[model samples]
Target: MAILIGTRDGVYRTATVPVEDAEQVLDSGDVPRVQTFPELDGVFAATKTGLYRSTDEGQTWKNLNVPQEEVYSVVASPDSERLYAGTHPAHLYVSIDDGDTWAELEGFQELPSRDEWHTPRHRNEAHVRSLGVHPEMSDRVIAGVEVGGVHVSDDQGETWTERRDGVHDDVHHVLVLGADEYVASCGDGLYRTRDAGQSWTSLDTDLDHRYFREAFELDGRLYAAAARSSPGTWSGEGGADAILVESTDSGETIETVSYPGGPAEVILAWTAVEGDVLAGTNDGRLISRDEDGTWVDAGMIPAGIRSLEVC
Candidate 1:
C-alpha cells in the first residue's frame, strides 16, 4: 500500500504509508488533485498543466489528451471505463476510454446561473473546485463550483439542475455520504442535506470564520477543517487561523479538535486508510493522530499539498 500526495510542485508517493517515506515520483507540475481507481489498477493526477495516469503505482506516468488546459479535479464513475475531469473556467469533461480522449459536457454550461458564476480571484471566471458521485447511483453526479453554487445531474452529464437554496454559493467541496445525504464545505460554512439537495441546513452557523474546504468521514465520525477567512488574506507564520472540527453523531453536533502542536496552519487535504486518518496542511506540514488522540508530525512535502489519496 502507498499514500499519494498531490502538491503544488508535483506528485509524491510512499509505499511505507508513513509520511517520512514519501518521495516525489512524478514532476508533472502543480498537481491539484490525485485519485486512485482500484478497479483499473492505476492512479491519476489532475495537474495544473494536464491530466496524467500511472499504472505501475507512481513509478511512471503518461499525459492524457484533455481539451482543457488546467484539470482541477478527476473522478471515476462506478463504471470502470468512464471517468470525468473538472477543469478551470468551471467546465466538465467526460472520458470513456480511460482518459485517452475526453468530450466536453456542453450541457453543464447551459445552467441558469452560468452568467453569474465568477470567482473572487479571477472575477471573470471560476473553477470546478470539487465533485461528488453517488456510490450506488452512478447516474447521479454533483459538482461544486467555486462561487457558482451546487449543480446536480441525475442523468449522468446529459442535464443539470442548479440548487443553491439555504447554502452558501461559494462551495469548496461536496461529500456524498449516502444516496440522499450530503455535506458541503463552503466559503461561508458547512451545510448538510438529507433530501438530495432539495433543502439544506447550515451546521457551522456560529463559527467566527467559515472558509471551509474539505471534509472526511471515518468510523462513523465526521471531520473537517476551516480557516478564519479566505487564503487571499491569510498572513503570519501561523498561516490562516485554521481549526479542526469533529462530529460523532452524523453532524448533529460538532466539537473542536485541538492538535498537539496547536492550530497554526490550514488543512487542505484529508484521507483515511485502514481506519487511520491523516491530514495535510497548506504550509507543507503533514500530521496524524495516534490511537489515543495525540497529533504527531508525519513528515514534510516540498510544497503545499492540495490533495491526498491511498492506493
Candidate 2:
C-alpha cells in the first residue's frame, strides 16, 4: 500500500512509514481533501486549482475540470453511480459519467440562507468544505459548508433542505456514521445529530477547545482533535495548543490523549493502513499508533498536510 499525503504544495506518495523517500505525485496546489471510495477506481484530490483523479496510486493525475477552479470537496454516491463536487462560493455540482462532464445542482442555490453564507475570511464567499453519504441512503447527500451550515438533499442533489439551524455555521467536515447519524466538526465546535440533522447536540460543550477540523472513527471509537482558537492564532509561541480526544460511546463522552505533536501541532487528516491508524498534522508530521497504543512520529513531509489516503 502507498500513503498519499495531500499538502499545501501538492500530493506526495510513499510506500512506508518513517518515509525514506516521498515523491510529489500531483502538483495541484492547496489540496483540501484527498479521498478514496470503495466503489471508485482511483483516488480523488480536491484542490484550489481543480479536482483531479489518480488511478495508479497517485503516480499520475487527470484534471476532472470542475467548472469552479476551487474544488473544496468531492464524494461518490453511495452506489457509485454518480459523483459530486463542491466548490468555493458554496456551489454543488454532479457528474454521472465519471468526471467527463458535470451539471450544477441548482437546488443548492435555492437555499433560504444562501445569501448569508459568506464569511470575511474567505473573501466574503464560502465553500462546500465537506460531503457525505451513507450506504443505506443512496439518494441522500449531506454537505457541510464553511461559513454556511450543513444542508441535506433527499433526491441526490436535485433538492435540498436546510439543516443548519442549531449547528455551527462554520462547518468544516461531516462524518456520516449511519443513515441517520452524523458528526460535524466546525470552526467553533463539534456537533452530533442522530436524527438526520433534525436536531443537534454540542459534543464539545465540556471541552475548552472549540475549533475543530475533522473527525474519524475506527474500531467503534470516534477520534477528534481541536485547537484553542482558529488558524490565525496558531502562530504564537504556544502553537496550536491542540488536544486529541477519543470517544468509545459515539461522542457521549470523551477522554483526552497525548500525541507526539501535542499542544503544538493539530492533526488535520486521518487514514487507516494495514490496521494502523495514522494521522497527519498541520505542522507536517505524520504520526501513528503502535501495537502498544503509543503514538509515535512516523515521518515528516515538507508542507503542512491537508488530507491523507491509503491506496
Candidate 3:
C-alpha cells in the first residue's frame, strides 16, 4: 500500500504503507487537491486538467472530466455523492453525480461584483485562497477570497452570497463550525461571529502584527497561524514573518506561542495526523511546535507548504 503526494515541482511521489493500516497509499501524482473517499476505495486529486481518481489507493489513475485551469481548493459533500472545487481566475465547479462530470456553478459565478478578481498584490476577479464546509450542515460552505472577503453558500455551491456583513474586505481563510459560529482570518487579524456572520467582533488579543493565515480546531480549542505583515504594514509584526496562537474560549482570549524563527520570513503549513502535527516552514524546514510543548523537527519537505488538510 502507499500514500500519494503531488508537488509544485510537477512531480508525484508515492509512499509505501503496510496492509494492516486502513489508510494506506500505493501511489500519488501531479495533483493539487488530494482527498480520500474510502467508500469508493479510492483517492481523488484535482489538477489543472481535471479530477483524477484512484480506486486502489493511487496505484493507478483515471480522469474525471471536471475541466479547469488551476484547481486551488476542493471539498466533498457530506449530504450526497458530490464534489466542489474552486479554480484560479475565478471559477467554481460542482459535480453532482460523483466526480465523473462537472459544470460551472452559475449561481456562484453570477454573484454581484464577483467578476472583479483581486489578489493581495494583484487585481482581477475574486481569487479564492481557501475554502470551508460547515460541520453541522453539509450544504453550507464558505470561501475566503483574497480581496473579496467571505462568500457563503447555503445550498451547496449552487448559490453564493457575500458574507461581508461584519468581515474585513481581505479574507484569506475561513472556518465554519456551525451555522451561527464561524472564524475568519483576514489581513489585519482574526475575527469571530456568533450570530451567523450577521454581527462580528474582533478578538482584541495580542498577535505581534501578524496577518492571520490558517486555523484549525483541536482539543476543543482553536489554533491559528499568523504571519507577520509585509513591510510598511502595521498590523502585527513589522516584517514578512509568522507565528501561532491558541484560543480555548472560541475567540475571546488567545495565547501566543513564540517559535524560534528569524526576521526574514515564516509560514507554518502542516499535515495533521491523528496525534501528530507536522508543519513545513517557509525557511525550507518541516517542524512542529505542538500543543504538548514538545517541539520536534521531523525533517524537511523542501517545498513551500501552502496549507495542510487533515485527511
TM-score ranking, best first: 2, 1, 3
Q: Which candidate is the best by TM-score?
A: 2
lDDT for each residue of candidate 1 in 1-311, tens digit (9 for 90 to 100): 77889998899988654566678998877877888865566888888788888888778889886888788877777777678889888899998887778899999999999999996586578888777787778888889888888889888887999877888989888988987788999998999998888899988876776889888898888988898988876677766888888899877898887863346688888887677888888877787867886667777877888888887
Q: After superposition, how far is residue 140 of candidate 1 from its true place, in Å?
A: 0.5
- What ranges in model 1 sit over 4 Å off? none
How high is the CA lDDT of each candidate model? 0.83, 0.94, 0.61
User: TM-score for all predictions?
Assistant: 0.95, 0.99, 0.79
Please provide, for model 3 over 137-252, each residue's C-alpha lDDT reduced to its tens digit, 9 standing for 90 to 100: 77777777767777778887788887676777677667666776888878777888876677778874555754766566755777776766743452344345566666789868
Across residues 84-113, which tens digit of lDDT does each residue of candidate 2 receive? 999998999999999999999999999999
Candidate 3 global lDDT: 0.61
Among all candidates shown, the one with the greatest lDDT: 2
Please identify which of the two predictions, 2 or 3, would achieve the higher lDDT against the true structure: 2
In candidate 1, how many Å is residue 246 off?
0.6
Per-prediction backbone clash count: 0, 0, 15
lDDT of 2 at 213: 97
